[model samples]
Target: MTVVTSDILMDKELLHKKELANSQAALLNVLDDQKKDSEKILKKKAVDEAILASIGDGLVVVDKEGKITYVNQSFEKMLGWSSKEVLGKRIVAVVPREDEKGEEVPFNERILNKVLRGEVVVTDLTNPFYYIRKDKTRFPSSSIVTSIVLDGEIIGVVETFRDITKEKEIDKAKTEFVSLASHQLRTPLSTINWYTEMLLTGDVGKLNAEQEKYLNEVYRGNQRMVGLVNALLSVSRMDLGTFIFEPEPTDIPLLVRSVLDEQMPHIIQKGITVFPTFGTNIPLIQVDPKLLRMVVQNLLSNAIKYTPEKGKIDLSLTLTDEKKCLLFTISDTGYGIPKNQQHKIFQKLFRADNVREKDTEGTGLGLYIAKAIIDNSGGKIWFESPVSNYIEGEENVGTTFYVELPCKLLEKSK
Candidate 1:
């Protein structure tokens, strides 16, 4: 120990000091990078705020627990609540939103909760609710809520909404105008049809061959005009929420038969084979006859129009196995819908390319009108059409439309 080298001890001390300096330098570099990251985060936040402020619709962001995390300027202006007041509060605490039934929903039952659970609610014009402002004044709002998914997990929700009172008023006025105009147009059209039919049938006097041909064309034109007028009127009523829904006891099988009879001429012309399967012991349920007739007529007419000669149509009215709903399926061996275009089948004025070329007379409003009527009656309508549904050698063999309605129309759950 007494002979230890003093020079070696001094060299060791220098090496240790150099190692400490290097460590300090690395730590300072990390601090500088962290500061730069902080600035970038602040800039990003500013950009987000600017974008959110520019939106015309009210926007709100809520965390998983439904706590209000962020809101845009329009949201503040619309609800009369600043972000500061709502940031930590549950969104339901500030809004006091009610369902269509006018009952205030609990926090867990609210649509916000549903969104967090991965249910997308997109612009429910049919089932909207009242949103109370900070001043306790309420207004009708149409809203859409979507989940904020991150890494395949629903972490929060974002809701966007707009006040629809003005829009509703405009729709009502438009509906009235359409109703009035349709009624006015129908009277003259009916007179024209009556006279044309009289000329054709010799009710007034016998007509020459050429005269009868011209009169027949006029009669057909008038009939088409009448159908357009009626469709317009029905669309107007649906838009205005003014459909007179008087539920009367109905015989569904009898109603179906009458509609099929109306299409018999077309069926015979096309050489289509039809099979009817009525459920045994079918019960009579109260439903709006005119509205349901429109549905059946639309489906049957479409089947007859699209199917080729020697095709088959299978019509059924059955009680679902659960016995809780009525299932009406109309399956037709026609040109099946294109896979890419099936989604647009129910849209207003939409026609598929394949069918449009074959039958140019379609107004494209049949399915749209039928969907609206069924939805109003608290039912569902959908279709399955694929090339695979046809025979092995056949392409675009057929399509099937299913209308499932509850035995008793249940009140809307909004």
Candidate 2:
């Protein structure tokens, strides 16, 4: 009986061991399937990321600790660093810094601190800081830094940068061209004005009536030529980024009235009736007086030049919205601009064909210069005219040019 019991016990133990082996094989198969699925997902993610990293613009990803977790191919190519050199390194090791004298300091200064504080920095990095290239050389760049936040927590930063050396070179060339051209044009213009004045004053010698009349014509032509040259110079200065605005607190109503006074002679000569109106107690505006004067002069000049003899021009200035802005309107009974031509009216050297045919003496630069002045002064200009052809007794159906300027532009000047 004892021998039989021992054999039975041994058989039961063998069966238990086989059952355990089968259970272990099932678990292994399940784990293998899970591993394959994870690997497939990881591969897909890597491909998507690689495509993004291959773009031309630089890209970087940092962890909450400001240590670089991932960097793109473009970023590596831009900064002369490899993945092994930059991964797990602090962002300060890669960002450029500048010294007190506006020179690159060539030291690692942390940028993530400022970014994590929720500041969006956009700057022309080419001016003071540059990216070190793979060849151990530096290149000019412009970059923007924006904070990355998740669930109200600062996670990291994203920086985009590009080389701008060529852009800077082009800007420099443009400035040089404007400076040289302005000098060349102004010199001849000054000489012309001086000589014309001398002749008109009879300082050189006395002249007969015929000679005097011819000299007067020459003087007038030269004056117009000088105005054109000056307008061109101002436009060039603006294009080259040399135009300066020195704003001062000025009375808007007074300025408009002064412009009207200066234009009175022409308004009378044209036989056009004039109506000037001012709103009660208009506030002063902060503006470059000279530039604002030009804007008003240009608008009035256009009104006078376009209006028919015996027509009317109305000028009005008013403070609106509780002294928030100064509104100016100059309406005219003129040969109204065609609807199609109105859009092109402010383009440089663009003249309405109808106006050119009627009055062949316009420079076509007045409106262009006026638009530029208004834009620089933080003002806006627009005009309204009828789309249909004009009929007799409908003289008021002409163009009305409106300008709106902010009062803050005046308050800040104070």
Candidate 3:
């Protein structure tokens, strides 16, 4: 009933061997494919590492939990902390942040959290912060932090920053040089102004109508130079690291009137009306007389320059509701700043197109210096203006500049 055959057995054995061989071939193919994929991944990782290492600015990478995962060589050198030392530690562990006033930035209000929370972040050159290095030395740094997003979720964060010590030093040096040069230049400029005044008033000698007109022109030009030098010196002084502060209990309305008196010539020439208002029962406040004078002069000068002939310029100084601060506002009825260009008006050397066309003699430094003075004095400044005020000749929309100074000093620059 069961007679086994050798040929049948041989055929069965060959078929089984062939099936096993096919399975082995498929498995080998899969293994080879996996090997290629691994090689690609390693190559990409190497490339990323190379790029981060070669960058000039410091680069730091952190995992979702905010632990430092990697740091480039530049980062190690700039921060004075080795990659091995920083890795696995909190990203902020190597350095702490501070504001311009040396006040510690609260951890909850940090760029790290903002990026990790998947919020849009933008950093500007002007908004620099202080970072303390591993050596315990502090330096200013400008940084931009971004998140590594994956699947609509934040997986990690990357920060790029650079030390601005050299830049700061260079800026300081330039400021000093400007201050020195302005001082040197003022001597001769003052001599010229004094002599011109003498000649005009006949203190030295009398003159005819023609001679008086020419002398007046010369005196005006000399006065302009003196003004320019004074402005330059003020800017340099503000830029100096150790500023000389002399805050005293002062009368603000009296100070404003003095500045207005000095600008009376320009006011008369333009035939513009000047309105001055002081809050009833305004109290004497402690302030830097020189610096506040600079701010008032700048605002009033700009108001007069931008306002058309016979335009109205209103200046007001009042106490806030809390009586904690003094508010000064200068409103002009001339050419107003465009809404689009208003944001950039205070930037250094930035001039709006409309204003630049109207006045070629403008240095674009007036507002910049004005803002610097107010900021360093622990005050805030802002402006509101319509784009096009030109309805007819002698009547255009205008700009209003506002400044709020603390009654007592804040922890602003000294």
Best model per lDDT: 1
Clashes of each: 0, 1, 1
Better of 1 and 2 by TM-score: 1
- Candidate 1 matches the true fold with a TM-score of 0.81
Q: Tell me the TM-score of each prediction against the true structure.
A: 0.81, 0.57, 0.81
| Residue pairs with backbone atoms closer than 3 Å in model 1 (clashes) | none
lDDT of 3 by residue, 1-414 (tens): 234677788789999999999999999999999999999999999998999899999998888887899999998888799988989998666668888779888766778778898776555465578988898888899888888988988999888989988988898898899899999999999999888888888997789999999989998888888887877787787667456767877788999999999999999999999999988776676778987888898899888998889999998999888777889999999788776566678876678777777888777778888888788778999998866432334236888899998966432222
lDDT of candidates 1 onward, in order: 0.85, 0.77, 0.83
Q: Which whole-number lDDT from 0 to 100 does residue 318 have in model 3?
A: 92
Task: Answer with 2 or 3, whichever has the higher lDDT.
Answer: 3
Which residue ranges in model 1 land beyond 4 Å of their true spot? 1-26, 88-115, 118-146, 338-346, 387-395, 408-414
lDDT of 1 by residue, 1-414 (tens): 343677788788999999999999999999999999999999998998899888999999999988898899999999999989999798888889886557787877778897787764444354568899999887789887888888999999988988987977786797799899999999999999887877788988889999988888888888989999998888878766677887677788999999999999989998999999999877776778888999999999999888899899999999888777989999998888877677678876789878887888788888989998888777999999875322344454789999988975422210
| CA error at residue 412 for candidate 2, angstroms | 4.9
The whole-model C-alpha lDDT of candidate 1 against the native structure comes to: 0.85
**Descending-TM-score candidate ranking:** 1, 3, 2
